[model samples]
Target chain A: MEAALTAGIGTPLSRSAADALNSVDLTALTPGTPAFVGAVERVLTSFFTTRREIVDPLGPVFVDAAEALAQFVVRGGKRTRPGFAWTGWLGAGGDPAGPDAAAVLTACSALELVQACALVHDDIIDSSRTRRGFPTVHIDFEDRHRAAHWPGDGAAYGSAVAILIGDLALAWADDLVHEAGLDPAALARFAPVWARMRTEVLGGQLLDINGEAGGDESVEAALRINRYKTAAYTIERPLHLGAALAGADDDLVAALRVYGTDVGIAFQLRDDLLGVFGDPAVTGKPSGDDLREGKRTVLIAEGLRRADPESAALIRTGLGTDLSDADVDRLRTVLKDLGAVDDVEGRIRDLTHSGLNAIAVSTTTGPAKKLLYDMALAATRRTA
Target chain B: MEAALTAGIGTPLSRSAADALNSVDLTALTPGTPAFVGAVERVLTSFFTTRREIVDPLGPVFVDAAEALAQFVVRGGKRTRPGFAWTGWLGAGGDPAGPDAAAVLTACSALELVQACALVHDDIIDSSRTRRGFPTVHIDFEDRHRAAHWPGDGAAYGSAVAILIGDLALAWADDLVHEAGLDPAALARFAPVWARMRTEVLGGQLLDINGEAGGDESVEAALRINRYKTAAYTIERPLHLGAALAGADDDLVAALRVYGTDVGIAFQLRDDLLGVFGDPAVTGKPSGDDLREGKRTVLIAEGLRRADPESAALIRTGLGTDLSDADVDRLRTVLKDLGAVDDVEGRIRDLTHSGLNAIAVSTTTGPAKKLLYDMALAATRRTA
Candidate 1:
């Protein structure tokens, strides 16, 4: 079933990977494991469904926003964040299928809700029209505004509405987390990670905005942004939070952090590559769209550093423009010529190897550990 | 300091009012009261200061939004929500000076932060340029966008940025509340009120938007909006949540609800009058602005129902326009001529009287009761 959800399931390597993942005895170890996953799935589905229902009570303006977010959230990507959280919980000797496990999943589910809110707001900031093969919230709302013949600019109204709805989602996420019923010590342990995650995400967003405006284009600055924006929240903090909840000691948590950091950065680097080169049908976004938005990715910075003066000028101009197909092809050629693509691919290999090594050396070993290792590998090695 | 805070306190004139409130002894509070009050004050002051410091971390793009929200929130408005929560805790026979008191105050402080988030977003929804004599967050951002040579239209970017910041604030509010260390039962007790408050506020906003856009905005509909939008969350929920935490019986809770409902409506009605007629210095708003904005207040609805045909048309056009001083005066005169102002005043009196009556027959009594009674009177009788 998991293989069927993706595009290239029949390839020998892909099939093997799927088999390896599925062969892990997720349900056999303890009844609690399946129960935890079940609880998370049930609660998240209910939360989002109820959210959809409640939003309509605010009338048409909110109805449009609720519909947009519902589609955005429900389009179904791999629930990697939740998976990582659950794995961490189990790897740290926590119960897989009990209430604590449910707590981990609940926290994980809330993280996705937070991600949804962040992405919706980010799309507005970037002015992108599509995400996950559907119209972005701002764009959807803007279209509705125009369709309804509202007096002002539909885009502006739509953007405004999207922002408010995103805020609502963020608020609701907190509410869900608080009601997760974690014990006091667990709650306290999780609070700092949660707080830091928010601050880091906001800081990362600020860095991204600043970089777009040519404020921080250095490789070092770009790496700093990646650490806060992608690395911390994506893998490191989630792992740390889950382990802490499961009563992992400081050294064990530190080991997980190292693994998470590498994997997180590698995952983002892969995404950067996919954003520029992946097939649209697979990635659900247009190739080279990130380049058109002039995101100050490490790949772009490296390419510029290696390019000739004239080519460098081309890269600079291409940073924030809506590049045509021809423009994207030219940029891709320049990147290849500069060897930036090879450099990024090499980094991805190193990061994946490092992360795998961390997991191997750690004292933890179980079905959950195996699953984490497989997930980290798949996350970094994906082509799209 | 307490004396200064409660100077010129008036006694309940009615026999029932005096009897219902006889249990309160403001002077004989428990030993921990001072410490609890001090902790809350310290936390609140630090929270605001920290908020101001962190708000503009990305430079001037966010500075205006930060400043506007800071000024609006830190100004001399009564901290009634927090006060009510604390008082309710006391009224329910909880120790006024214990850790519970601190917990209640912390929870109450979180409400202020939530309110700040809601108001900032609300301003964007309403498109009001000024709030409390300062430019609204969106407007501030819009002005900054124009002032700076940023990419897109300043207004659009401003609105987008404002929305993101509001989301941030909302998220932070929930974070604070969750970290307050309230026990599960305490948290659960407060959950429904918290949830309903959010729903009502959002629903009220929708009703306001729909009503202004020429929907079926009957007087009955306007009253419903008033109850949901202003009354429930603003007073009733805060009081009820506090009382519930104190283990107040159903009768006590119900009595507070009756009192809160009446006072909350009266509070908004008085605000409508002040919106049109109060001094700018006192109200922190330009006089007659509400007339220009064409807020769908009960006063306006009443005026429309009673005004002659010619006056009604003029009022309709004036509802959402940027009215000149002469236009505002003309509309006010027409409203007065139709006796809508008098009608609203009568309603306010009735509501206040009913609220006082509810308070008179209540079984619960304490310093908290006296404080509540005073607050209800002051809220309903306010001129500005």
Candidate 2:
């Protein structure tokens, strides 16, 4: 299953290239990948530490709020977006070994905070009780309220706290970027892309939420939503941001967009398949969450496209349903029988190749190109 | 009641200065004042407009979400925070006539966004049904969901929308600043204050929320909350931000803080009194909203302090209750009878004078200093 595709690279590998050649996993092999995320985690710790200093003068309760957000940011996340950003910077001929690299890394770090905000709020929107295999922020706060025997609806209180924390994370992400002391001209150049990413991500999310309420059933419509929600924020925009930081010209940025887009769509396709059919132990989510949420993914759209009328109706019922595990299994078979599963897998393979080819034709350094190519495989082919 | 305190300054007011001198009402006068707020309002409109352009490319439903945030930003708020920020820039010996003035104004405009985020989420925390004379964002969304024949809990959907919008506002505030092309040095100088304001406001909000849940009832505790939530973010940080933009010395920053603290606390204390006593038409809120929300203001703490056991019990009963009009009126009498109203009034007067005196001792220019003095009166003494 670890289909280390570097097994087929034609060129001889260097020391850094060896890591790219050695594994297809984004999580374990990338140098300072752990350190990059760890740095962000440490920054998160210090953010709360500094906040507690200010808030301590106010009250312990305020510290409690800051700590909760800090924990949320530091604890979860795969740092996938930031990893792409860093690679995009490196690929755009930016010196990873330069002093500006730290600033760029810090800028990359901001994405994690944005991701954290998205996740917390997404959970609230979906009424998801868990994330990363733990109680979600809203549920955690609800439990705190209930435990404290606070007046008012525990759910309401939980939602309020979650809202504030999400807002705080959004604010802090900006704070982190400005604090990086990046070149002003570079920052000015980067603002539009950064602003676009933030708004597009939110827009994408709104579309997803709207779709869950039963808007479009077409695969084209579903893919459009996925393009904005998953592709832009998760990969394309991040790569664009890093490219901007690296002083990338329009042509290079355009090339990365092509690479990021195709790769990004494939990434979400894999996630959608996993949501229904992947093991909970591998996915770190309860099995069939997409089915429970009635996610209108392209895979689901395709399934409905091919199903018989009665079968399609039964498939529709699974959207946002509280079905038994066996019922979910039965629906899984219906999707497989309709050829939706096979269709998605085929599309993912084609998309991944196009994405890898985008990077290959671009004027990126060989090592960074290998990394991006590896990242694409690792992202779309992961079990978890 | 209009205590026109253009006290004995030797010079005749310029046309612009005349407007500043003519009225102590912040909502009404000064050159760029109405025009300044108007400018910020327009900028806010364009922010969502641009977002709509991006989001529209995604889907009509996302455009719906963007439009809601834009309208909320445009249709409401006094632009009070930006007002203070712009004045602070002028007050710190920064030339209003300089080329960089527009940048300062743009920087000042960011405060309104922070304010919007805080207000939306605050309403959620307080379960406030209306703000600025309309259904709060959550309630508006809830009504829309109910009307649209959408499935699931309308309130939850509404809350989810409100949360996302608030988070967007927070993110956009940062975007606005970076997009303004402020000097890197000045931006760096301003970053800490901006960061501090966001976090402190959140901490303050948590304290206010915590207090309403029966955590604190003393005047000291309430004032502490006020210092963070209202005073710091409202006046002090705005002034500090403006002063930073102007490259003001630390002494000037500290001086503005003193003024902002006194004026800000006075501002909120007046609001507490008005929650029970002000005219709804003037206040632009449902009469007694804060009272209904059971906000733990210093005024309430004062009432609880001097109240007889029966009166205190009556006041306690009003905290977080679904009180009828008759009940609100009765509790209003308890505050008045206990001399809590008068006590708060006295504090307001003392604080306003202290604020004015703080500005007088600072190294601010005359016209801008005059503006700050007038603003203090305008903020604390307004009916709304």
If you score just chain A, what TM-score does every candidate get?
A: 0.82, 0.87
- Classified by CAPRI criteria, candidate 2 counts as acceptable
Instruction: Give the winner by TM-score.
Output: 2
Share of real interface contacts recovered by each model? 0.13, 0.49
Writing each residue's lDDT as its tens digit, candidate 1 over B1-384 gives 113112211111111111211233433433225543444445555554544333333344344444555555655245667666666667677675455654566676677767777787777776778766678877976776566666656766666656666766666565556555567678667765675566557656655554554455567667767876787768877777787777777677777777777888889899988888778888767779788767888888899899788988998888778898898888889989999899999999998888767767876576666777787777877777
Off-target runs (Cα >4 Å) in candidate 1 are A1-41, A48-72, A142-153, A306-309, B1-41, B48-77, B127-157, B279-284, B307-309
Q: Individual DockQ of the candidates?
A: 0.14, 0.26
B295-333 per-residue lDDT for model 2 (tens digits)? 788988999899889988888877767888888888888
lDDT for residue A312 in candidate 1, whole number 0-100: 93
Please state the error at residue B47 of candidate 1 in Å: 4.0
In the range A144-221, model 1's lDDT, one tens digit per residue, is 667766565566566666766676567666655655657767866776667656755765675666566545566666
TM-score of 2: 0.88
lDDT of 2 by residue, A1-384 (tens): 002111211111111111111212222325336665665555455544544435566677777777788878888876788888888888898776565766676677778888988998898888889876689998998999889887778887777778778877887787767665578877766667887789888878777766666466799888988888999899988988888899887667777887788889999999999999989987777899889877788999999899899999999876787988998999999999999999999999998988788778888777779889888988899897
Rate residue A118 of model 1 by lDDT. 84
